[model samples]
Target chain A: MAIIKRYRALIILSIILLGLSLISPERGTQALSLTSASLIDMFSLLPPILVLVGLIDQWVDKQVLIKFMGDDSKFLGVIIALLLGGLAAGPLYIAFPIAITLLKKGANIRYVVFFLGVWTTAKLPIVLFEVAAFGWKYTLIHVSVGLIFFYLVGVFFEKRFDPNTLLKEDITSNE
Target chain B: MSQSIFLYGLIAILTGLSWFKDRQKTKKALMKAKNILVKLAPELLAILLFVGLSLSILTPETISSLIGERSGVIGVFIASFIGTFAMLPSFVVFPLADTLVSNGAGLVQVSAFIATLVSVGFASLPMERRIFGKEFTYMRNLSAMLMAFIFSFIIWVVLPWL
Candidate 1:
């Protein structure tokens, strides 16, 4: 029963895929292959990283998190957010779980939002690749404009969102 | 992949160190990890399935053709729509954008594509809403799409000048 509840969406999508296959075998086959590949990618990519977050959760003091990335961390918070986003490697979806981890650990909502923003553009290795592939001028504009723009958006998000409302969903689900 | 290996090695070392410090605490963390994975798996699986379905139809070639340089503002708009809906890794994103541009896709169009590709998540909305609530998810995505348009214009004017 629990399994059915948990996999409801997956089951629905699978049915849709099956229906599509009846209409077009080629597309169905392609979607299935692509999904399996993504499955492998997600498994390989997420476990170690999520485990790392769990360890950080167990080890890092809430107070420590607050001091560094919390509400009043201000300039320091912004820098930390950028570094976290810039240094990471993974799909943008990966950032969500990690951001939740930090937010729950008491990091400021501003930095959490900013961190997710940064991950989209300024991932360091990708940035280096961008410079080589697209040249310095294009790369510089993308990163600088991306970073500055996202930071302002982050500020807007901070004002607009209530962190508790976001995180409250967790508490209800846990029950 | 090297990235996966590096992460595994890092996790192993950290786990060992954590175990050394306090065995009980380390056990708790491991259990926590298990719980977190379980809680997340369902939503993640659903997302992967949807992405697969969408990408099957919206192949990169389809995107590249639509966003050609001559397509102009219309191309930019189309690229934004596609980018917002599609999700790709950063590594794949640049190379794909590079290919599109090489194939005579305009800088501004590709820029919109790349920008919206990273910042927006239309397909991922279901999962995001599950975590962040409905309003924040929609607002964030809308904001990202707007930002992508604004930034694309910035690149259109600025990169040429630079």
Candidate 2:
């Protein structure tokens, strides 16, 4: 029962796969193949990230993090957050674990939120791709608007929740 | 594949450096990484399955047809919703968006699609909720969706003036 509860989401997904197979075997097979490919993609990418996270956790001093990205760190904090996020090279899901790690290490909620925001908008490689596909005008509006808007959203989130209590739930907590 | 190779190489070099400095701390870091991977397996599996299911059903062809050139306001919402669910590669997404525009999809609709595609993730919600809790995840996604809309609106207003 405990195992079932823990694996319920995966089970539900399996059932959905089964249902799709029953309804449309072709689509089901496509989904299965795609899922497997992405699963491979994820497994490859995730380990180094987790290792990096763990190393950061064990090696970096919390006080140093707090000093750099803490509530009091102003202009420098924003630049670091932008650079850290904008230079990233992965999907948004990749940013979540990294963001949580920074939060756990005493970074300010505002910067953490802003970092996640910038990650979504301004990943450098993707930005270059966007400029090529959509022109500089379209790409510029997205980066500029995304930055200003998300920073304000960060401020809103900062006011809405306390930093220490923001992540009360453990990473494994599904409840 | 090359990205993975590069990352692993970087990890090897870094871990070697740290191991020389402090074997114990280095070991602890690897152990922590192991522990986190164990704990996160279920959520990761869920995300994998969801992405597979979503991608199969929400193919680029399906997305483009739903976002016709004359789709108007309803089309924008549909495009954003599709963007949130579909996890196309950034490389695939730009070209696809470019194709859609050339094939006559409206700029507003395509902009909404592009905005939410990068920022929002309805598909990754379980992993997000598992990590950041329910409220934070909801707030973040909602805010991202809002940003997507605002971005599309800006494109609609500004491009004409430009």
Candidate 3:
């Protein structure tokens, strides 16, 4: 009951969206339907992946990851963070719980920043797709530029926002 | 065979290192993942049904009308921005993009749209907030959108020359 109350808004919104999809889908709006379906598909992947990530998070000790992603140094930590993020498989949704867990484990904000950036920006599988579709040269150009830009953007945001002040959820939740 | 062995050895070393740090944590995380999978399996099936039905219903012509155009940079810009709203997996988008490219859409525009589709879309907005918090979410998205446009332009200008 309490859980239901906690996520009432989400539950309501999801229900509304599902209902809308079921009935009276807009006409000539193939874009709308396709997007809606894609959203549902994406959401479908989220729960299981997130649950797995959440469980891993709950059990994993933070000290080791903390050392890896600590505030003590920026360069090595950000590099490792970006590599881990880029190498990671699964949807961006799957990555979030792991990132949040790392945050709880004491990873620095900048590390998280880089991970999020690369996780979204430089997916290895997607890169391979680009390579196959476009040429290796084109793919390389896009990914190399993208990685540099992702890293720079991540650092910029991390410095701009003192995550401690901006992210309030960190205050309440340990998960 | 030799290269494969080296790769395996590297992976073994990495796994060993992770195990040394926290075997229990990884084990527990995997267990939690199992539970989550069980819970979400039904939803996943439903979502797949939705995707298949929606895609099946819509024709390529419909998709083309919206984003496909010969107007060099402008069409690319529209497609990339619109991609921020449209959510589809890379696999699905690829075939569609190939079709678009074959039809009339430019390479750079498709590339830009693909980049935006993955990086800065509305699809993951809820999860982004849940995990990274809202500030990170907003900033990352805004940056991705800007970069998508810039990269699209780069691809357009450069592809012609190359």
Using DockQ as the measure, which candidate wins? 2
Pairs that clash in candidate 2: none
lDDT of 1 by residue, B68-107 (tens): 8889889999999988877765677888788878877888
Across all models, the iRMS values in order are 2.4, 2.3, 7.4
- Native contacts present in candidate 2, fraction: 0.69
Candidate structures ordered by DockQ, highest first = 2, 1, 3
Provide the lDDT at A38 for model 1: 81
Q: Locate the minimum summed-lDDT window of 10 residues in model 2 chain B.
A: B85-94
Writing each residue's lDDT as its tens digit, candidate 3 over B1-162 gives: 243344345545544565677787655555655554453333343333334343544456655665665656777777776577565565556667777777766777777777787677564565466546677788888888877887787877776677
On lDDT, the leading prediction is 2
Tens digits of per-residue lDDT for model 1 on A1-175?
9878767787888898999899999999999998888888887778887778778878999999999999899999999998999989888777777887788889878898889888988899888878877898888888888778778888888888877877866511233
DockQ for all candidate structures vs. native: 0.61, 0.65, 0.25
Q: Which one is best on TM-score?
A: 2
lDDT per residue (tens digit) for residues A82-158 in model 3: 78777665555556666766666777777776786677666676666666777777777677667777778867876
Q: Which ten contiguous residues of candidate 1 chain A have the minimum total lDDT?
A: A166-175
**Deviation (Å) of A24 in candidate 1:** 2.8
Write down the RMSD of candidate 3 (Cα, Å): 6.4
DockQ-based CAPRI category assigned to the predicted complex of candidate 3? acceptable
lDDT (10s digit) by residue, model 2, range A47-137:
8888888788888999999888888889877998999998776788888888888898889889999999899888888888899998999
